[model samples]
Target: MNLYQKLVEIRKDVINFSKDTESFGYKYVSGSQAIAKIREKMDDLGVLLVPEVKNTISSTYDYINAKGKECTDHIVSGEMSYKWINSDNPEETLIVPWQLYGAQDDISKAFGSGLTYSERYFILKFFQAPTDVDDPDSRDTSNRGKGNKKGLSEAQVKRGYALGFKAGYDKANVDKQILSKFNKKIQDLTKEEYEIVCNGYEKRGGK
Candidate 1:
């Protein structure tokens, strides 16, 4: 590898690294190895960065490059996968372009000011947000554990109304923000009234 080989992308989302849409899928990339090592002491808490023998920028490019590749395996999310760049020619120099995205919302709502973009948070998010590692295929068909999507979906709205109706004030409080968007009578809506509401949702193109 040359002195210019950047092992990790500065941003958070790896899939966005391509010219158009990247075909390769790589995970467990520590944004910076120094960050990964510092987070390692969390004891099974799964951190992204840490310090190894004090990674200093003042060091030579060769030293930095060597350190990056050497500590590649020590990354907390130990495994990463990507298919051969050219399926037809598996002999090619393993072409896996490392790209990172900062955060989804930052990219979307970012103003022209570069300072605002830099201030945004760094988070690792998957398209479908894969968590399982047991399967060989890249597709995450099974979901054993996961957090709710950052944005609300139709399913989420429906569930919120359902719980509110069933448990009244208790369920309404389950997620106060969501409940607030619901119709005031949502808690009191009966089976028939609920069906009516759902029918309206369907007609309004709820999905």
Candidate 2:
């Protein structure tokens, strides 16, 4: 079988990793847990997953908080290349590239966090691994009186709309074009419409 087919087979057998760590009142599967599972299967599949750190950039922003306290934000951006190698053929290989950004008060902390974050997502996506918990960023909309319309909360809709508008407005008033195509205002858009606009923004590399 080809590398891609082998990957699909592997994904079928993979199990959802348990969340063994908690922070900020949220539970998540740590990078260590995810990598350990992948490592256990790599030898049998004759595939080696390697991550190379390509580049890193750092920037600092100064601002004041609501209390008028001076603050600084240090952001670290990193690029990573993940490679899947077939040991038997040595000629069959797959590469996936990813970029991630992290921010913290300490410079070293920012870069360290970004690197770990990138590595975790790289492994997860490549292996199509499942997690026991939903993404923390996702909101539970069932109790919000809207009866979980299309599985999105009112807050999520608002946030997605705002992101879409930001992307469109910054790019030649594309927001109006998107709204016109949907024939609806931002607040009135359905979950699918909001997702479409948000996806368009992502396709345009608008973060």
Candidate 3:
């Protein structure tokens, strides 16, 4: 089969979430898990997937921690391209673009984190891995009855968890930071407060 045909076959394969890869109280399909499964399929089909970093930009941001102490962190943002090459016909290939971001207190780790985050997300997204989690928009009255509608939305909570993990913070550290700043758990944070938390993570707690 050709590269596209092989990819379509791969897409038809079922990739279940790794129940052991838990973060923020939910199981996710980890990068290694996806790679392992996909790699097997690729080898069977004589297909190759390669990633190339196109460009990256780095900068520093200043922000206040949950302890109200000012801190600076290195942030990296970049684009990468992935190539799907046909093993038999080396000239046949398809390229896809991916945008990624990462932040850390250590300059040495910023770009590495960004690359790893990008690759994980790319694999999951491209493969359409089953996360076994319902979409936030699927809820109608379930959240309304709990009065959680007045607090952070399900989408915001997921985003917060994702950003926190990407920035190399564990669930305990994330909740501790939130509690220190707002005296509330993630589920209790208002939309505005959640925005502050997201800003801290995405923008390195700046401004």
Higher-TM-score candidate of 1 and 3: 3
Q: Candidate 1 — which residues are off by over 4 angstroms?
A: 1-157, 160-184
**Model 3: lDDT of residue 26:** 49
lDDT for each residue of candidate 1 in 60-150, tens digit (9 for 90 to 100): 0011121255211110001122222222332432322221111112322212121122111122222222322421223331221224322
Cα deviation of 95, candidate 1, in Å: 36
Task: Tell me, by lDDT, which candidate is best.
Answer: 3
Name the candidate, 1 or 2, with the larger TM-score value: 2
- In what order do the candidates fall by TM-score, top score first? 3, 2, 1
The clash count of every prediction, one per candidate, is: 14, 0, 0
Candidate 3 residue lDDT tens string, 1-207? 888899888877636545457644446666677777788888888889889986555655555553679877776655578888989898999998876566778866877877787787777778776663632222322244344345554334545665665556766788899999999988678666876887788665221
Q: TM per model?
A: 0.15, 0.59, 0.63
Model 2, span 111-158: residue lDDT tens: 787778777876666665665255444424423444444434434443
- TM-score, prediction 3: 0.63
Tell me each candidate's RMSD, in Å, in order: 21.0, 7.1, 9.2
**Model 3: how far is 3 from its true place, Å?**
0.8
Error in Å for residue 1 of model 3: 0.5
lDDT of model number 1 = 0.27
Cα lDDT computed for each candidate against the true fold: 0.27, 0.62, 0.68
* Candidate with more favorable, higher TM-score: 2 or 3: 3
